[model samples]
Target chain A: MGRLRPGHLVEAGFWLGLCLFLYVYSFEFDKNIEIYKFGASGWPRAIILLMAIAAIGQLIHHYVKGDETSSQIISAAVDDGSEEAAHAAHHETVKWYLSTFALLAIPFIYMRVPEWIAGTSEPGDAGLHTARLIVAAILIAVVVYFIRHHRVRVMLMLPLFFAALLEDFGFYALAPFFIIGVMYLFGERRPRPMVLIMALIFGFMLTMFVKILYVGLPVGNIEPFYSIGSWVVTVLQ
Target chain B: MDAFNNFLQGSITLFSDPINILIFLGGVIGGMLFGAIPGVSMLTLAAILLPFTAHLSAEQGIMLFSVMYCTGVYGGAITAILFNIPGAPENAPTAFDGYPMTKNGQAGKAVGAAVMCSALGGVVSTIIMMAATAPIADWAISAFGPPEIFALVFFGLAVAASVGAKTFWKGWLSILIGLMIAVVGLDPVGGIERYDFDMPYLLAGIHFIPTILGFFAVSEIFVQAEKKVRGSYKAPKLSVDFPSLSELFAHKFAVIRSIVIGFFCGILPGIGATLAAFMGYNEAVRWSKTPEEFGKGKLEGVISSETANNAATGAAMIPLLALGLPGGALTAMMVGVFQMHDMQPGPLVFLTSADLVWVVFAAMFYANCSILLIGFLETKTIINLLRIPFQFLAPLILLLATVGAYAVRGLTIDIVVMFLAGVVGFFLRRSGYSIAGIVLGLILGKIGEQTFAQAMQMLHFEWSGFFDRPIALGLLIAGFLTLCGSIYGAFFKKAKTPQTPDPDSA
Candidate 1:
């Protein structure tokens, strides 16, 4: 038998452990509900059994496939990479990790903010939810700059920063800034038409969503936004 | 002729009121915008707008929701065609053919074909729903029970066999994982929590909308990010080339067949436009003379899926209006809208609110017309989405997807869960697992479990009693046949020549 790679072995172990956890968890399912003939645990146990069967099947497939082909393929691929290619691959891997980190951390930050703001056990209390979305976007930009290519990182910064300010500044306050940030990120140095379109879009959103539809737009977290929102709502009504 | 006069009366009533016209227009435009935007689902928009409709008169309220319902299904195909990112899950199939066509610089033709076929399907199904509501409702009411529903869902899972994954076993494994995820909440029959791990969020169960946003939109964002890192990404030209009239006429039979498939699938309780789209696409592939052209940008593939999904819109109302049973989630929300207006659906609703029913029928017709008009107008602008730098557009999609996930339940956990699901989905797609198969499994698993448990309880847990119900037995046989066919196709089909891609391969 060909020796299995450590990665394949680790994968097999992971599935096996997962199946064991599911099996153990199935036992904790309560079964006392009178309406159910076989109780709640019965279905879960049946599912767990099927899952165990599948896990075993997965293990065998992995072992046999690994023995037949994967090792040879990996060896051939590894042999083909030159020094420059190897360096590029390492760089790509770093970028991948950076992107993944941003993806994962932003959600964590967003989840944790409500608890900090409201002193509540709930991780995303309603009061802090929208605010946290903005903060998370800002954090994502900041975090990406530290780990990502500088050019790409610069592109991510402006839009994310403007998005972070959207809740505090409201539609009228943030719309032009967002458009400007987008154009700058895309390297649009000619800004006259961009500004014109942004003005029209903001007008459209204000009329359509705020005045006509009455959707709950956060009238900026500050005074002018509140006054603008009040003026728009009153005028429309 | 009496039906004709009632229809005319309803049309007049609907068109005569300026407010009603405004309501219909709002629903169509709003529904389409929601549908086209990534993360905004038809159900979510319908739910949001539903509360506002309470103040309107019953006719206006129903008209508003009805137009929203019809146009929402039509709206997602635009984004699906332009970007490979499907605005809704059902539109994913459209992206297979539609996006490829866009890549070939025929986005105009693709969107035009999709719009024409979708409108055709919607108009045809609305007519059928208006004409055959009673008869179809009678059949559905008699044929469907818990056992039958369970069997139908089981048959739906058999679709995993046809999803053309690299490995059929991987697809099955994905389905199993989805099913397990579905069972994580309370047991439907016993009302006892199964897999909450003592978390309050898990106790309510996994919401499918957020899960869908994760699987389709967020996952695509991750894939795009990876591509940007690899420096292999290029934005497509945004110009759309409209299809010639002859091209639209060419797929006449496929459109009709898809409409039938879509309507029947929609009539079945719990089955929705997503399944209809899949089954319709599959059936078109089954019958096509040039089946190999399907995923590579065939017009028939686009038409079949779009027509079937929209056809489902009208047929879905059949069960709701005729029997008071919601055919799917959107209609279930519509049922709430009806109840808020002191109206109830079902047979009595027809007798008591006959004119209102006709008005709804008229509204649907108007909605389909609006889909054609507004869809044509928007295609130029929507196609220009491909012109935006992919790097810029990717972040925008991420923003919309986050908002969509949050909008579903107003929970931060949902957004977190969506991101997690995206990470998982990214790997699953890379490994050639069937993302569609897993999504189907997730959507149908809860319904299957609930119905199966109900059937078991009804039969006192005598497993053999399932076969006693003729409808259930027939559906079970169908499920078995589909599974066997998949296994045969997987193992027994001839290997392709090295240079040629298999027609069935994703």
Candidate 2:
């Protein structure tokens, strides 16, 4: 009925492909369970089928109503007519796409970085820990140096980097840097206020999460950072 | 009479302990503060606190969440009235009239009416919840077998999928994705693994907490980050002038109707306060003598929305407490709390943990009552927190979300899951998918599978057995009709309407 947007086609295609892949994968489940008539795969298969149908329906709908953007639909649901939704509806630039890609890479980096570093070493090897600490230092330095220039992209990538290094660097060592980095990216330029606010937030977090709740936050496995984290806990206790 | 006595006993037990009183106050204040902050949902705070709740006594913990539920629903109204930024999605409707009133320099009256109406709605709904829950649980326990339970879950999932999405298909697809996520672990009925892919972590199933933190908190941060990148809003001036008793009394009918609408909406398995507020505002407009006054600084608009959303908070607990079907994401998190405390929510909770349930009831009642005083006194003070920029708040939220996800199972993998879920959730939200539907589907999926297995066993593998059970049959019919209706609305009904070219298309 109307000209279809390429974005809608891609989205529909992604859902369809995902649903089909899962449907095929569902067949791998053991089907010969003695107690129940519907086997283990039955429930998943049903869901996969439903998902496939929905995806196809979405494709059809996209074909029929090609002009309606997802943001418009969301605005309709929100019904606020706010400027925020209007801004969100605007076409994304290459910067937005790159930042999104970087954001999506966070979990992969978190999972794979250690594996890449360890490289056939046993878990908790001394040498491996030393290697991880050295690499972490280098990476942190690079991130800190680049963050000012690539604020949004680096900010997007910071969480996983923080998470990955959290155990080795400890919460105390990394948290302030994380806070300062984010605040800086957020356009907090004045050094005095940034440091003061960071200290306040850091103190509050230390008192609340670690001291009061006993949340077992990671105190680094490596030196200096580990000692700092332990020292803070000791003082609070 | 028994319920009344239990409620009184609960109140006495709650007020007797100084620590509990402190916890009650803390929860109310904390809930409101968190709820009032733009870019932070109550779910984020709930998830962050979920790990710590394990340490408190079950009554104290559950009571805390119940109190938070009430205040969090009301807290967003202040920001909506003053700044035009709803602290939560449920408060979005409040800004329609509330912000308009602020533009007209009636900000005080708008905020006051919102405060009073929110409390009134919450108090009335809590009373109704106290009366309704036990009977509903008892009836459900007795009348609902596995087949009927499955049917009910089906109906709930169907209704959930059809609500919030631009197209019904997207909503259904979101639920299907959630169901798919739920199917990842070992099959509940049989010991057979379905999608674990030989991973030890996958065997235990994906914990909903990290998934929720990612979806609600992390994904929200990304969305907000994008918004910040685009542009930002300015802070508003702080002042509140409460309306007189006579002024409030004039719109009594609107208040009553919203309470009713909110309560019924709340009792539904998947619908939550956001929809209730919108429905309430819509109904208020429909019933008003001069409907044009709505969305143009009408006091009734603020009153209806604030009232209904808070009203839904208490009523939402009904389905959660009675059937273990969470009315929204926060209630789903409550299910996590229940599991942590070695308690199953459904009907047996009424028998085994009646005191806990009653305490929650008492806490909600007190919490709602406290909102009137606290809302009146602390509106200006609370709005000050909004001055903190979204950029500063964003990273802090991410850090908290990290701890929250990691704290749940002490698994680093879960943190990864949280980030992955966040990225996916952002994309999904951008595509008009319902996050609530997916979350509900994930919860309901597990229950539905288990019940379906049990029902099949009971029926000796006879597929037709579902048709024999009247309740099951009825629920199935309802589910089917809902799907059919949604399909018609999405496809056939829309086909009949005149199409206009979207300006963005050009």
Candidate 3:
């Protein structure tokens, strides 16, 4: 037991946990008609056994044949203190990761929480999408607050998330405008030519994929959005 | 002779189409460009182009893409020899010898030898691919079953175990970790979610792109980021050279040896071009009259390495087409594209799309020819990729990584998975565990599962019934030997004098 390595210990611990969880999986599986002499549990049980052997094998190999200690591996990793120094010295966008985590967490909440209470007005607007928008708004507002408070890791999520959404809203026409807005915001305040670049890119993509391939896009009631393609489809029809 | 006639006909058709000619040229050019640009990986290029060619005849589409694969591998040597930055993994062996040639004022000669040797190996492997494919496909079709597939996966895992790192235990650990991750999403048997905890997207299992990108590409980023911050980042002088015929003829046997090594390596199933190149170089160094001149400027060095790398391309495609086991990462992408095109890739595919497979073989031929022609022409210009500033280029690649991951399944969850995987990969890589095994594992996991699960059903879940199939037993034995051989080779090989950094590269 003492011969076990930290790696194996951790791995074995995981396996032990996984074995317990397989019990939950068993509930969903067929209990009728044992396929093997051991039933369906035969293979998964064998897998657990293999995991234990592998962990033990690792422990024995390291303890018996190896000479280097854990400190050597640790030192080899931490020897480069320069990276941490660089990060410290060049630190600017502080709330970047915070916003990213919040955004990721909001989606998880949406998956589980049917009636979340964050906005001034409850997103209990009696729709699935309404809940999503409210969650997005909360995520965006929380991120913006942190970005303003800390002023590092420049939170670029608000612009990027909204822009990607615009492509869905049938402002399929306004998609390029979104890129320009995001690019300018990302570029830190010069959003003009970047906006134009987005327009050019959208036009190019539209001509290439949509026009040439005859694929349709969601024009989302944005009236100016659906024109040439719709007319072409009509002509063909 | 019928197969030979088919190849000749493929060649004939290759010349008949001017559009194909332009594609061949474009492939060569694009290959060189992508190879020289360190962040623009061939897998990314192959994956992106896979969908765009949906309308083309299978042979034409394959011909276009194979050109990209073969040339990309060859094109990487330009940067390796000129800038000392191996633009691709297989090119790492070239930088060892080719950059030394540049320092000795024979950059052109090194490049020439590399191109020529790559051509020689490619032609040999292409011929071998054409010849061996039918027989292998026949046997593979006859033997294909669940037990057989499980045996193949075991063998693949063994290859990863034996070849991964110094310690066999860590390699096994790496494989296990990959298998665990692969178990995420739906259980293959009844489509029950195993690790997803009830998420909707998890029901389909983890889309492979995120896993592969995490294991290979993102992990690479983590490694680069950490190393870039501390290492003395130097670039090689962009001196270009091509070797004379005499210099190449002297190494003709070396080229043959490397191609043989590459073919065998590809047949083994999971290990890819990098190993083939490394193995070829090691053998060249071992057998050379002046073994001392290996890591220094040697025409034979670049020749031996590039030839094997390119040869592996055709070699890898064999199993993917025949048995539906993807030969490597690029082949896996091709398999995905094949599925997207509504063509199942295994033996049944032979009966359904025999003509399409021939088209693929035909495309492989033209692509090989294109690599030979345009690869040489693009060498002089490949050095400009290093000119891009690191600060700007790194994030651009990260953004592309996000886009690439998202494109796979049209999910933001993929992007998040990609980001997390990248970070995990970075640590695994620095710690010396092979990421290759992990990627191979994730890709092979489902294939392994379906095969294993099916075998279970076939046997009436009998434990002893799995080995009843001669083919399954044969594959098991082969896998065991391969695993043992790789471990013996990697661990027992004597260390040479530790290599120093190339001054020209610095």
Candidate 4:
């Protein structure tokens, strides 16, 4: 919360360690199949090697040249706000990270649940297989944990869970409407008109990619829900 | 003699096309708009407009793209002088003196000098490009065997390494990182993955669209995230007056010198106008009787830098249009545009499409004239763009960065890439490393890789192949001399600062 420290050696070490791990893992490539001359792992290996070397060079610079000036710059960055003010400001920031993490966990949790009350037992394709879907969900959650701020995390989940659910309930186009409602209105505080403008923009994008571009989307068990999209696609064809 | 006569015929053919003039004017104006705007990039314009050129003949498309390249560079000076913020990365030097000058109530004069100087610079570069390109292309087409290419790649990498702070190890290390990132995709020759990590995207390695947006646009957002961007710059109330005769004559030597230096720098693949501007600015500062006036609002500093940067634009096209070696991003875009219209860019390009080459040369000259006109007429309007409040601007900037990042791959994956790159950039800055060199190296990494690999293969993996290529050998010598120049730059820059207690200790 005070500020991030500029410890070149620490960063250099971490990246170097990651590079080594990636290289070591690359050794497990199945050579039984002749995909290409160098195999799948060659490019990754080269990247890892170069990254490791770069990290070492960074460490060397730290050791020999010693850039204390940059360290002071980092310290000065946070000092503008007194330490107390910074401490107080940090909590709200952390909340966004927490929310984003929780939002990401939803699909994974649903996957681990053994049985659905009523729905298709099997997903449509290989990518949508129940096991793969769960893995994908978990991957997203983990990635989101590292990536997004926590405050909007829960709001992000509102899309797939609620909107996608409503689409199955026969409100096909309307299901996406709820999504805009939740993310734009509920997530951020703006006057209703501004929120409406944002919602319309989102709607336009939905219409473009889904209806105009004819992108395939899963609408759950809801029949007659995507009639508008289907009609548009039919017309274009 | 035959090629020369054919070239003359081609020039006549180019001049005969009325549509070519319109294309030239449109490209220059559009390029100026793109370069002045924060989110709009030269590559973006080139890529988007390429499809439209599919209907035209190859020569017309090449001419249009060249205009875009030339004018996009000229436009950066507009925002740089008016706004404290630099619209394009290359305009950083312009912001230093130009912004300070604007605050000194010479906004009109600064814009005038920048526009005029840039025009002069570009015109000089265009002439040089036209004169030098044909012979150079002939030489390159014959000489660039694999060994020469290998040597050239090494030279480019070394020049990239020369740019980062004094530590050679750090610079090399950065190049190593860039090369590693470049190595992730499938091998072109061997047809195998090196570091695919089993991800489908990894198979393509990293595309320029996503990577450029990530590193340039997104990282910029994160770095400036905590700070306010928009500064209070009232448009100065005045007329567009040309520099007085004596004032023009006083800076004649610097202007001519910068154009020459910038042209040479531009002829080299990968260095581009950014370095040309910096070189010009440095020399101007060093020679200035009022070196102290530079960052405080000296018109000479602005004139030298703006002139050289725009000049480098036309010069960069010479290597690309004639020799099939693009010296910068804008010219690289030109190569794509040319290919789209079925105009192959190479040594044979001039021979097969002489009219197209002449059209591009003609376009470069006209684009300078067009920018000059726009600069003269719309001087106040352009300066007033600086008056917009930073708070309102910053959020819009973030949105644009996000939208642009998303547009790159049409993948959410790129959005994630943008965020990651920003954080990485932030941390790199925190670590006292020069991101400038690393970013530049990343951009050039693939060029070096493909060139090196091809060159090596042609040599049958012989080490001496690099030395055997005459042009490659010459470039190596040039690269070595540049290192010496950088050292001298550092030494002199330090020596001039008398206020520092211990210059030696520093």
Task: Score chain A of each prediction against the true chain A by TM-score and list the results.
Answer: 0.47, 0.81, 0.45, 0.46
DockQ of 3: 0.13
Measured with C-alpha atoms, the lDDT of residue B193 in candidate 2 is 79
Taking all chains together, each candidate's TM-score versus the true structure is: 0.67, 0.93, 0.77, 0.71
- Best model number under DockQ: 2
Which digits, one per residue and each the tens of the lDDT, describe model 4 over residues A1-237? 122234454567678788877777667552422423344454456656766765665565456445322111112111111122223434224454455446545543454442342234453433334443454456445534643343223333433333223222323344334333433322234557445544555455446545564443333332344466455445544
* Model 3 lDDT per residue over A1-237, tens place: 445455545545655566567545655542333333444333444554555555555555555544222211111111122233234434213353345445535434543443444333342243534555556457556655654433212222332343234332343444554444334323324455554555566665556545665544444322233464355445533
Number of the top candidate by TM-score? 2
**lDDT (10s digit) by residue, model 1, range A156-176:** 333334333444455455555
Q: Candidate 1's residue-wise lDDT over B212-274, tens digit each?
A: 666656555554444444444245457656677798788888888999999988776545676
List, residue by residue over B125-220, the lDDT tens digit for candidate 2. Answer: 999999999999999998988999888889888877766665788888988888889998888777887788878999888888888888878777
Q: Which ten residues in a row have the lowest lDDT in candidate 1 chain B?
A: B495-504
Candidate 1 CAPRI assessment class? incorrect
Q: Between 1 and 3, whose DockQ is larger? A: 1
* lDDT tens digits, residue span B334-426, model 3: 665565566656766666765556656666666666566665766665556556544334343444455456555556566566656665665
Query: DockQ for the candidate 2 complex?
Result: 0.40
- Per-residue CA lDDT of candidate 2, range A1-237, in tens? 355666677777888888778877887885778887778888888888888889888888788766343321223333222224424645245456665585546435544565577774564677777667666666667677777666555655777677777767778888998888777777778899888878888887888888887777778777778899999888887
Indicate the worst ten consecutive residues by lDDT in candidate 2 chain B.
Answer: B497-506
How many Å off is the CA of B389 in candidate 3? Answer: 4.2
User: What local distance difference test score does each model get?
Assistant: 0.65, 0.79, 0.61, 0.57
Q: Between candidates 1 and 3, which one is better according to lDDT?
A: 1
* Model 4 lDDT tens row, B395-432: 33333344344443455455445545544544344233
- Which segments of model 4 are wrong by more than 4 Å? A1-6, A25-51, A68-237, B1-26, B38-65, B164-174, B221-224, B228-242, B332-345, B352-356, B385-447, B474-506
